[model samples]
Target: MAEKTGNAFDLNLFKRLLKFTRPYKLVFYFVAIAAILLSGLAVVRPLILQNIIDRAIIPKEEELLLYFVSLMLVALVAEVIFQFLFVYFANWLGQHVIRDIRIKLFNHMVGFKKQYFDKSAVGRLVTRAVSDIETIASIFSEGLFMIISDLLKMIVILGYMFYQSWRLTLFVLLVLPLILYATRVFQKKMKAAFEEVRTQVSNLNSFVQERITGMKIVQLFTREEKEYTNFKQINEKHKKGWIRTVWYNSIFFPIAEMSSSITIGLIVWFGGLQAAQGGVITLGIVVAFIELSQMLFRPLRQIADKFNTLQMGMVAANRVFAILDTKSAIQNNGTIKLEQVEGNIQFNNVRFSYIEAEEVLKGVTMNVNAGETIAIVGATGAGKSTIVNLLSRFYEINSGSILIDGTDIKDIELKSLRSHIALVLQDVFLFADTILNNITLGDPSISEEDVKQAAKEIGIHDFIMSLPNNYLYNVKERGAMLSSGQRQLISFLRAYVTNPGVLILDEATSSVDSYSEQLIQQATEKITEGRTSIVIAHRLATIRNADKIIVMDAGQIVEQGNHQELLQIEGGYYRNLYEVQFVSGIE
Candidate 1:
């Protein structure tokens, strides 16, 4: 969330945004030059009109009329060309700036710690990357350059009006102060409204995205009407936010129109009186003043609107910069590199907490030698999954140390540390891509032949070959096209292909069918071969053959032994857990 700056134009934010445009300054300079030319050309038409009326037509000089008309036509053609360049290059620069920003924003998000994502909404982040950035582009395309051009035109027109007749020019500007005051008020109110609208858009997007992704759960729980009611509440907020902006627009534009009419009326009355007195004002002067008044006030009216665009863009930039400014707590300061690790692991008095003052891992220490299979059995929320997260350094631990082959895991580069370890979680997530791509993860070094060989080694090659397109079969979104069992097999093949020095299976087969369980068990045997492995499971049968079993209770290790060796204890936590699971057939 971004804090409100309350100013109509945030100068600091604007300067920061201007930094992204530096790479395309050549195009932007061309746009600025075009706007300058267009502003100068805009006043030529009215000057030519005044000359035609007073000098050429009234004096009956046909040749002078033809000459002035030709010049006017030439000015019009040049104005049109400049206008085209202004629009084209302005938009071109805007698109390129947004492209660079979107990439930077995405790359920043990719490096954010997992804890940041745990609290942030996915759809909100997407909105920032997509819609909010689009609004920023409009600041260039329809806001900044246009406002500058309009301001320049107004200044030139005002200068021309004064040169023609200072008395009439003063009359036309009599109502200007009132319009300026009203515009100031409108800008402040509209800035707040646009900010509210952007916030509601993010909220609406988040709610809709969450509901759609979890639609199956909603339907299973018969929450259709309930969810709809919630959606309507959020949608209503979104509507009200825009309506507020619309209301401000409605009030301000009418005030501007009435003010313009009053100025024109003043010009007519004063000019008419001056003419009646002693030919002090001409008909040509009055006509040209009318045109000049419109040209002057129209951009003033539109400046208010374009300022709205500028403010919205500033608001969006503030939000995006807030994200970019967020520093991830998980710093990767290690420089140590290893071609291969021996797979010995240790947790020395490790302690952790997802939230402050409520520890999840409490001074639990463990060790595993090379090529040893360790099973961790614990009740739900006993910090089983937290161990895997800490091991991978997805979240920083509060105290104590985790070591791999006598090297502090923190002392090793994150990429080097994780590359030697593989994790196969309980819920397998596959991208909307081919089976081969999911298995190889687009790693060109791991070719099709490598994937097939690994899958065959894990006993899933036959199952994949039976599919419609075999290795090329598309998994669709989140692997929706495949069964949970089939997705699990793919995950197994994915892990096997990596051939990591250490493997961690966090309830990998706990939710699969009996047949899938049998296949996964076989895959597990091949994957854990000659590697250090940690299996976290609720089913006691899965870890029956583990070299050592560590029983956990309330975030602390209570028992450690092989399965049979621990099951023989009369009332040990492991034995009781085994009996309960065996009797309930949860194994």
Candidate 2:
């Protein structure tokens, strides 16, 4: 089970949740009208029964009997019609409300900073998006209407019962105080149990997602048994949550039923004595009163059940609001567009840290001419990739000014800055989509020929063409259907088509094999021509031919020169990396 740490109910959150339904106000009113009509019909039915017994059925007056029978039938049919209308409108309103909420939440979440993803689990977010929304939707559609109907029914029934006989009504209403007290206590307990259920379900969802996404790793490590055991433990916790929920419901219902029976028995004994004492109430009125008492309790039972459902829905609403309320760490200027640029980049006294204890890049400064290829090479964690991230503004510098064409990057609009740079990473991620759509990123304006040319430039044109469907071939989630090398080639093609002024290749060719690497090397050369590029590679030979090589270590620049000049130094970090590369039999 996912750990239950956060509170779900806040008035401000509920207010926001209600705003999502404001658009469907008219339909909600229609549903409310239907419920009111239905409640009134329920009250009239018992009185109609009392009338039929005293005036029609007992006296054997055929005309009165037929008239009363017709009235009862009309009421019954009207009740059914209103019930359908009530359900239909509520369902319509609920679906649209949830749809609005999900869209708003989704848009908000995607805009959140990288730090949010770093802190929260993917599985938990997925639950908020999918399962939590579903639960809330159900509650809005059915639970809300049922509660309204039950409450209205309870009021109407009690009012009529009291008018009939105040003494007996008081006796029946006496049990209600105790029921209300028990309901309050049980509701608190039920809410806690339901909260646990929500947590466990989220945890189970995370576990399943982790296992499925990392199935290859699990199989390779032979940890299936361990995963199974962990899953079983979480499943048991989930079961216990359900068990508590059931225990509460089971005990509460029987107690409610017993209390209801006590109320009914009291009415029967007291009403019989009144009838025996030459009271105005008839036997039929007594019978109707008995039925009316049952009617009162029936709606009460439904109200209780609906109340539980409302609690669950509120929990889900709280979670959904929690996500919507989160502020993205990466702030963007209000501007919508950025001016065109020549792509001259500068970093002045830049320092950055992903964590407090360790700085990734420290006191680094560099300048890139409009169209120069700057290759960054060093051992892993030497701040090479960190420089790429900083340049792209994925992570803001702790202290520094990164300027594009002399304008501080912070001043330039975020989307505009990103549009100028196309980043191709080593770990390629692809959605389940056609190759063409993946390359174009669902932009319908891009021509098919352009996509193909980009693929050919990346030297993956032949591989794609060899497939029966060619560019129409579907790539599975994360490109599971394609090899790592093929996915990388597709990503390279995607960046090529964008034709951005600044290109970033962060270990871009690291995952491909030797044969694929050679093709990538040639393709990289073609694509990097006349484009400002930052290449972060462990392969020293890949960057040896660049215009400049920047060697970084411990967030600081330790060496800066052409590869040949760095190689001339016998003992520098670049020289040592170069020696290791050549000794490892890499070209």
Candidate 3:
């Protein structure tokens, strides 16, 4: 594993962020044009005010003053119209960019190697997808618009002020050095606070999600009081995070406001003195300088704050991009399609290890003829399930080759390999949907007749029919409405309907009751006929009739033969397991 790096808000991150909006460049161009035109009105209206004071109002020319005032009104209206267009387009671009980012993140996550998911928590990934993305979206919309408009307004106003009277402009800008220094200090502190807030939000979201998903466990243990205490602690952390952010923000505005007040006061006092001494400062000049003074500090303040927003956004982008950068350890080889398969499988010197130093399968070789039923029994963590995962290409083998019909499984396309195989996992996962949907998952195009036949074959059709809505009855999330046996039966039907050439049953019968297990055993015997099957079980009696049984211990096969052959060795683990069950029955 690579060491984690904490370069969350680096310059390169901004470059990557720009790439997301590259597709919508035209929208950005339109927004920029509208912003410039709107900001130009800011400079123009102030000059119009100067004209009224110097040429019309001071000379007692009401008619001329009214004329210039009307022009100012027209400029203001135009500015409002352009402002509306700018806002609409900026928001549209922001939302579309966010949509693209989410789609990219989702596609990347699903394609990630199983190892990434094994190491990452579900709640953390969920928060990255939702809360983190939303934070970046806010920066895209509000932050971008404010920064651009403010920058343009400040630039144009400063140029106008300088052209009118440099002396007055200098007076207003006297506080510039202090403001810059203060802004830098505040922005750094604010960014740190914002980062803390972002982390706390994710933690709170993750806690809530875990509580809801594990509500049953909580209720079973009656830990509602404990859970509430945990929630309160997490919530308090979030509260403190926000309070720190507010503390930083609250102190910023007052300093900027004070500077603006001092600037305004200085301009009025100094400019008045200059005008009294028959200097170039006029009432109109003073008014324009004061107006432009406000324009200068507003954008300056925004520029400071925008940097903080960009910092938060960069942290979010780092997480999102980190997911996007992950490469899947297992990837499709060539496009190998099995239009027709004989179900023959061969494992040649197969070796696998989940971790580097620990070997799970060590140079084991086996070959199964087409349509053969093979059972693999082993102690827990003996790599029985690992072999099945390899067959499905869920995890790549460390060193070995798995062949289907004499062709290496890696040579075959992953989609084709998986499509030809069906897996009935021990833990049945049903969606929050109707029973029909769950059964039809294996083959959505299956006909009603086929569905009914598959269901009846698993001996579940009658039970399903007894329900209030039969197939349409909702299963609830995770199939909570049904017993464990019913869920297993439904899973069996799903696999049976697929009619796959290769079938893997990994503890598929463990959850079913004895009666249901008998029915399942019978149904599965018929289903595995003329099809390759790999059965894994802990129960000693479940795989007794298997064509071959391979017993494993400590990642190597210790026994391989028929059930009677294994039983002949009375002291072996399999024999011991069977005898223990036999003795328990006598009691």
The most accurate candidate by TM-score is 1
Q: List the residue pairs that clash in candidate 1.
A: none
Stretches > 4 Å off in candidate 3: 1-9, 276-278, 442-444, 447-449
The lDDT, on a scale of 0 to 1, for candidate 1 is 0.91
- Model 2: residue 247 alpha-carbon error in angstroms: 0.6
TM-score order, best first, reads 1, 2, 3
Runs in model 1 lying further than 4 Å from the true structure: 273-280, 583-586
In candidate 2, stretches whose alpha carbon ends up further than 4 angstroms from where it belongs are 1-10, 334-336, 583-587
Estimate the overall C-alpha local distance difference test score of candidate 2. Answer: 0.83
- Residues 4-56 of candidate 3 have per-residue lDDT tens digits of 23442466776677788889999878888887887788888779888899899
Arrange candidates by lDDT, highest first: which order?
1, 2, 3
**lDDT top scorer:** 1
Name the 10 consecutive residues with the lowest summed lDDT in model 3.
Answer: 1-10
Candidate 1 lDDT score at position 208: 92
Q: How many residue pairs clash in each candidate?
A: 0, 1, 1
- Give the alpha carbon lDDT tens digit for every residue of 461-518 in model 2: 8989987699998987988889888888888888889888899999998778877787
- By lDDT, is 1 or 3 better? 1
What value does the lDDT take at residue 240 in candidate 2? 100
